[model samples]
Each structure stands twice: as C-alpha cells, then as structure tokens.
Target chain A: MMEPSTDKAFINLINQNLGIAYKVSQFYFDDAENRQDAIQEMMYQLWKSYPSFDGRSKFSTWMYKVCLNTALTYLKSNKRNKNEPLQENHYHLPSEPENNKEEELRLLELAIGQLSSLNKAIVLLYLDGFEYSEISEVTGLSKSNVSVRLVRIRRELELKIKQKLNR
Target chain B: MDHLEIMRNQWQGSGKHAEFTPFQENEFSTLIKKQMKKQNHIIGRYFWGTFLFHILIYALMGHVLIKYGIVSSDQLVLTLSLFGIALTFPFTAKLMIEFKKLAQVQRGSIGVSTIKSQVEIRYGILSRYFRFKKLYDYFLIPIHCAIGAVLSFHIFVPGSFSYVSFPIISVFVISLASCWYAIRSENRTYFKLPLEELKGILGDFDKK
Candidate 1:
C-alpha cells in the first residue's frame, strides 16, 4: 500500500515530469513572466490530480495529458488584454545561447506562436514523434482526427516558418 | 525535411530546465507546500462536514423516538450500532470517489476547451455537463442531510416523557440554520478559484 504522503510523492513525480511543464509553458507564452505563470498553473493542476494517478499509464503520458490540457485552457481563459504590452519580465522567449540550434529554435518558436492552442498540441505531439495512435491516447483525440489535424498543422507550420526565416 | 521533423529537432535541441527558475529552491518548495496545504484544507472540510451532518440527523431522530416511548432504551443502543457499522465506511468511501470525480471534471473541462478551440467549431455541448466542483457539492449535500437526520434522532427523542412539538420544531429550525450557514460559507470559499479563473478565461475566449 502506498503511504499517503501527497506532498512528497507529488513533488517527486512533478520533478520527473518537469520537462513537460517547461515545453508546454514555452509553447503557450512568448513572455518570460507569462511563461512562468503558465508553468505554475500547470503545476497547480498536476498536484490537484496527483491522488488519482494510478500509474497504469506511463507517468509522461498522464503528464502530457495534464500539461497540454492546462496550457490550452489557460490560453483560452487568459483575460489580459493583448493591447497592453507585456512588462519586461513577462515578455520573454526561451533563450538559446551558444548553439547551432538558436536560429532553428527561434524559427520554430515563431511557427508555434502562430498556431491556435489546439493546433499547437497536434504540432507538439507530431514534433515529439508521437504516432497518430499515441497522440490520440495522450490527447483524447480520435486516431483519424489526430492524423487529419497533423496534416493541416504541417502545412500551417511550413508556411509560418518560411515566412519567419525569410524575414 | 518536413515541418514536423524540423520542429522535432528544434524542440529536442531547446534543452531542458527547472520550471521554477525564478525562485530559489527553498522558495519553490515553500510555494508547493502552501498549495498542497490549501488542497488538503478543502478536502478536510468536505469530509468532516459530511461526517458531522450525518451524526446530527441521527441524533434528532433518536430524540423524537425516545420522547414518544416508541423505542425502548435497548433499541437506542441497537440503532447507534447499526448506523456506526453500516454508514461510516460507505460515507468515507463516497467522499474519496467524489474527490476523484471532481479532479476528472476539472481536467475534462480543460481538454474539451482546448479541442473545441482547435477544431474551430462555433458551439459545443460541454456547458450541459456537470462542472467538477459543482457535482462534488451536490454529493456533499445529501450526505450532510443524512448526517443531520441521524443526529436529530439522537438529540430530540423524548425517552421517559412524550411531549414533542416545541423540541422538534426548534431542532428542525436549528439544523436548517446551521446547514444553510455551512453551505453558504463553504460554497463561497470553495468556488472562489474556479469561478474567478473560469470567468476570466471565458471572457478572453469570447473575444476570439
């Protein structure tokens, strides 16, 4: 029987899945401050649902479900006016210093920024090498629908990335 | 290379980092602890509230029966024994299940909202489903009423004597008042986060 130390167990599990939080947060917000908020909100959700994680599915799968769901919902519900510029702390892109990957990351970030929240999930899963079936499992999408969305997403991302690189 | 492949490389190369970069280790731990405590507090309220309310209901019933002499002293012992054995475990189990259901509902809301926006459908039926926390509250109400009924039985029964109007009326009024206050206070506190977050998010979603 598992001991009921929720705090200890939850913190450990979250630490293991930290990358999911980072990726989802990065995808959701351009500003550093907003990114942090998104990450924190995601943490809140994960911890709240920690008790129900029976471990039948992989931890990462459950986390992906939690993280993607939180990010998209948070984006939908974000009430801050777009007209207002982000405070310096809030408007930040993830840094990519000292690597051949910088330009690629910048371009990719731009591409993600252009997608709707749901489309972003499909793209993230696709980019992460999630097959249609796995993507459907994590996202609760039908396999056929996941395939269809990924096709559209590929077209959209290519156009967006090309425009960014050209600029 | 395909768009998906290009993104895969970029995402992999972006690297990984702690989510709580802005906060020091101590500060981050403290924050997580505070959040965990808050959740426990909410769970405790629901559990104990159900427990106490059930006790109150039986107390009231016992009192009325005893006053009428419809029940002997030995019968009082039997009723308590049956209630303790039969109801306690079921109530706690139900609360645990309710907690799980509540979490699922919350997750479901986020998932549905995300899918809805992506598919770009004009309308959806999610609003018809039970909100996670609201369903939790609904389940809590009957448990509380059952507890109150049990407690009332114990409290208002007139064993040796048989006059009931005043005591029964007062007991009912007191139970109703207490239940109302508890419901109002707890509902206001429990809903503060979801409603605020939902309203803000829904407002932004509407603008799109």
Candidate 2:
C-alpha cells in the first residue's frame, strides 16, 4: 500500500507521461478499441507494479519497460484469437483529409504494424529517444543485440517507406 | 535527413494529430482496483485448485494402500502403487516449485530479464510435463490391462498362464498405438505452435 501523498505523486508522474501510453498503444494496435484496451491494460499493470519503481531510473524509462511488456503480452494473447493481416487500410489512420504529412505518417504506422513484435518494440524504443543501453535495459536484451536489431529495423523501415512512396 | 531520423521526427509528431480520449483518473482508479482484484482471484483459484487436486489424489492413494496393506500378495499391484508414489512425489515437488515461481511473478517488482527467464523456465517445465504425460499414458493402458489379466487369472483360472488374455492384449496394443498417434498430432497442434511463438519472442534476447 502507498501513502496518499505517494499515490498522488505517482498519478502526477503518469499524468505527465501519458503520452508514452498513447504512443505505445497507437504503435502496437491497429483499431481504436484494441488501442484503448492496450492502454487500459498498460495503465493497470503500471499501477499494479508502481510500488516496485525504485527511483534509480527515470520514471519514463520504467514506464517504457512496463508499457512495452504489457503491449507485447497483449499482442501475444490477441494473436491467438485473430490473425491480423498487414494492410494499411486496417489501421485507423487519422480520419481527416490525407495531406502529404498524414500520408507519410500513415505509411509509417502501416509499416510499423507489419514488423515482427520484437522488432516493433525495438523501433518504438528507438524512436522514443532511448539510448541503446536503455533500450537493452527495458527490453532485457544486450546492448549489441539492441544495436543489431535497430540497424535491421531502420533498414526495414526505410525500405517500407520507399516502397509506399513509390506506390 | 536519414531515413531513421525522418521516421523519428514523424513519430514524435505523430501524437499531435491523434485525438486520444482523455483519461479520467477516477474511472481509471476504479478499473485498476477491479483488475487487481480479478488477478488476485485468478491466482488464488489456480493455487488452491492445484493444492486440492494433489491432496485428493494423495488421499485416494493412501486409502488404497491402507485398505490393501503395503505388502500385498499381489506383487504387481504393490509394485504399481510404489511406482505411482515415486512419480507422484517428484511431480508434487516440481509443482510446488512452479507455484512458488508463479507467486513470485504475481508479487511484482521483478526485472524484465527475471520475468522472461521465469516464463522460459515455466515453459520448459510444462513441455517436460506434457512429454512425461504422453509417455505415461502410452504405457499406462497396457500396464493396467496386464495387471487386470493377472488378477483375472488368479480369480478365474488359477495356476494358468499369467499373461494378459488375447482380447485384453489386443485392446492394449490398439490403445498404445492410438496414444502414440494422439501425442504426435497434439504435439504439433497444441504444443509446438505456442513453443515456437515463445521462442520467437525469446530468440532476440537469446542472441547475446
């Protein structure tokens, strides 16, 4: 159990870092309902494991570990029930008129969705500005392993984007 | 800009266009509490259910041993009971260890590597358990039939051939064959798929 003050502080931290939840949910899920469920599950896990957050790492770093684990677990369980096809139309891209920037972002989301689950986590961590060591820490992979995966992920993304742009 | 940087820039700006439903703290707290309670209930059920099942099996075995006496004239039955006890003790010990690991996982604060290793260990344990079960099932039918035949010979045809009757032998062979087929089919459908999925997730971490 936490003191009221501690609870308040934790909630405040989450409030500030809510963007982490949103970004992760968006990257990992294609539809709004699934994204919402992922966010809820992540927040629940974060809260459930809140007491273990020893302030040695940045709260966001810890948040990344918790959020990514939750999303990975969510995806694994969901995969058992549904075989998601990798089509851009399946993603809930912003429903507004598609400008060039929106198209690019849509392509990026589609590309991210198509990556293998572990690769998706690596790319999301990379884009979130995590250093290799930090990504390794959160993902339980060695730094060199993270680097190798990141290099492959970047190449894959570049090719995916190029193909989409050509189309 | 390089492809990576361009994508990173887009990722950073991506949320700007996303219209997230604002999270209500009160509602979230309520949901969290409910989820926590549900998780606790599930853990409780699994732990207690396993404990009760073990107790029930042990009690039944105890009753049989006490009723028949440990040193039975039927040497085959005595040997079977002793074999069962041997298997049960080790199985119970392993189950306790698995339950302890599961409880540790439920009680949070562990690192990602620790959790991953725990999951991997649990998977190994389950895989081994299934393999043992398949082997046990394959042999159990024949063993039981042979035992039944011995008892029947003692009752019906005293001082005769102490082997299984031809019909029982046929049934035993057919059952053993079917058990082998079932294990092979189930290994592919029920076990291999999940094991592969788990390996895929763990493979990245294993590369180092």
Candidate 3:
C-alpha cells in the first residue's frame, strides 16, 4: 500500500471525493480560514485512516464519515467571546433578497448553519441522500433516533425556508 | 412535497453552498511532511527525556551512597534520597504505562459505527490520560525534586558548607512550588478546555 503506484491511486480516489471535505467544512466552520484548516485536517485524517478503508462500504460513505467525525472533534477557533453581544459567525437572512434563487440558497445555508452541531451533521447526511441506516451508522445514533430527528429537522427547515421565501 | 428538495443540490457537488478548490499535491505534501514531524510525538520525547533525567539522578544518588557510606554525616540525606527513589520509581513506571496507553489513544478508535461511540471512546481514554498525568505532576515531580535537591546540595557542597543545610530545604521548596505552579497552569491551559468540551459533547448526546 506504501508503494508509489498505490499512493497515486489513493490520491486519485481522494481527489474524486474531495467534494466531501469541501461540503463538510462549509457546514462546520463559519470563517473561511477555519474552513480551509478544517479541509486540510479532514484530508490528512482521511489519508491516515485510509489503510483501514477495508472497502466494505462505499468510498464516499466512508469519506463522509471521516470528514464529519473530524469536523465534530475540531475545536472552533471562532468560539464566541462571552462578553461580545454580536456573534460574527451568526447566520442572518439578508434584509433584501438580491437575487431570488441565490437568496433562497443563502437562506437555506443560514437555516442549516443555525442547527446544533450534531443536527448539522444529521441534516447534512439527509440532504446528501444518505439513508436512515447510513446516517445512523455514521452518527452513532440508533436508526429510530435518526428517523425521529430527521423528521423534526426536516419540518423545522421547511418552515424556515418557506417563511423566508414568503411563499 | 419535498420542500427541502432544493437543499439537496446545496449539499451536493460544486455549488454556491459548497465551494471546493481542487486538491493540490504540493500543498498536501508540505502539510503531510509537517504532520509527519508532529507524529514523532513531543509528549513521548518529554517522557523519555524525563526518564533520562531520572537515570542521571539514580547514578548520582548511587555514587553518594558509595562515597559517603551509610554511617557518615550524610546518612540522613542518603536515606532521604533512597526514600525519594522508592517513591518516584512507582510513579515513573505508572507514567510509562500511561504513555503506552496514550500511544494507543493517538491511533484513535476503530470501527466508528457511530460518532457517539468514537467521541466517548476518545473522551474516556483522554480523561484517564489526564488523570494519570495529574497524579504524576502532584506526587512524582515533588519527590524527584527532593531527591535532586538533596543529592546536588550534598555532592557539590562539602562539610565546610554543611552549615548552609537550611538552603537545601529552601531550594527544594522553591523548585517544588515553582514546578507545581508551572504544571498546574500547563494542565489548565491544555487539558481543562478540551476535556470539558468532550464532556459537553457527550452530554449533548445523552440529553436525548
């Protein structure tokens, strides 16, 4: 596995799934610098954990698991200051929808960003089309709990998205 | 209707929600090299370095016992050194055992079927690691200091300066106190927050 050809193959596989890191980091970090750092850490962790891949699960599923786990464990560099009334990272719906479609997308991001860190991971999995079992397996929650949480999360998200849309 | 349908596109490939810069092999190689440097384990180095210091202290104490003989004026300090070595040896061994456990912890939890289990496993290992470290800091450091202070004072300063024996006790107190403060602060800075965060995450899981 340490051979040059193997390294190239591994790198190629990682390159293909690099989007997982990008998306996971986007959900996890508020600031761009921290997002960049998160991506690097996730990639490094993926490489380190690559040998244990076993190929039993789909590579993308495994990649998401590693990325989510890394993000969960990563200490937030932008943790709110106790005295500050403003949260620089806090999500806000814009006063004016500059462009209808972009605003909807932005609102979606804001609503999701505002979820609890655990919920963020859950919703990320759901929106990415992961099954209840797959989400439960990655999150360590029971299948029933995953179903329950997703139902609540979906309802909550839809309400927010619709209200923001004024539909 | 899947009102949340639009969000699926948001989470998937190369969207405004998720921006990706393709992987650069050179940047990754540099980062990988840096991580390789860290994988050398600074904590491991520190412990081994401390172990080397212990070896030196042992040699010094052994020489004093040989040079001064048990019945000499330095008998009291020799006996104290023996006591220090006895107490310190067990803690040193415990620290080494903890070190090995730490190595395993670094390897991280496997079969991460659930994120909760992974967090819990890491938390459990790290809490145990910090506990062992705290015990070593509180007990072993003081004992080792006493051993070193007593031996160094005896070996370097002969009978002519024996009247200054008060200084040996004073020096031991000062070193022990300073080390106590230093280690306490270090633990506070490094261990306190991470452990609390881990605990909080576990609590988040349990609150369900």
DockQ of each: 0.14, 0.35, 0.32
Please list, in the order the candidates appear, how each scores on TM-score for chain B only.
Answer: 0.45, 0.53, 0.68
TM-scores for all candidates: the values are 0.49, 0.71, 0.74
Clashing pairs in 2: none
Q: What is each candidate's fraction of native interface contacts (fnat)?
A: 0.16, 0.25, 0.29
Candidate 2 chain B lDDT trough over 10 residues, lowest sum:
B106-115
Of models 1 and 3, which has the larger TM-score? 3
Model 1 vs. true fold: TM? 0.49
**Model 3 chain A: lowest-lDDT 10 consecutive positions:** A77-86
- Please write out the lDDT profile of model 3 over residues A62-167, one tens digit for every residue: 8888898787764441242221221324545556768877676676677777677788898888888898999987888888888888788888877787897785
TM of chain B vs. native, candidate 2: 0.53
lDDT per model, in order? 0.57, 0.66, 0.71
Worst 10 residues of 3 chain B by lDDT: B104-113
TM-score between model 3 and native: 0.74
The CA lDDT at B160 in model 1 is: 34
The DockQ-derived docking category for candidate 2 is acceptable
Give the per-residue lDDT digits (tens) of candidate 1, residues A21-50.
Answer: 887776666666777767776776775566
Residue lDDT tens for model 2, A89-158:
6864566636876676667767778887777878888887788998877777778988988777777877
Which candidate would rank higher by TM-score, 1 or 2?
2
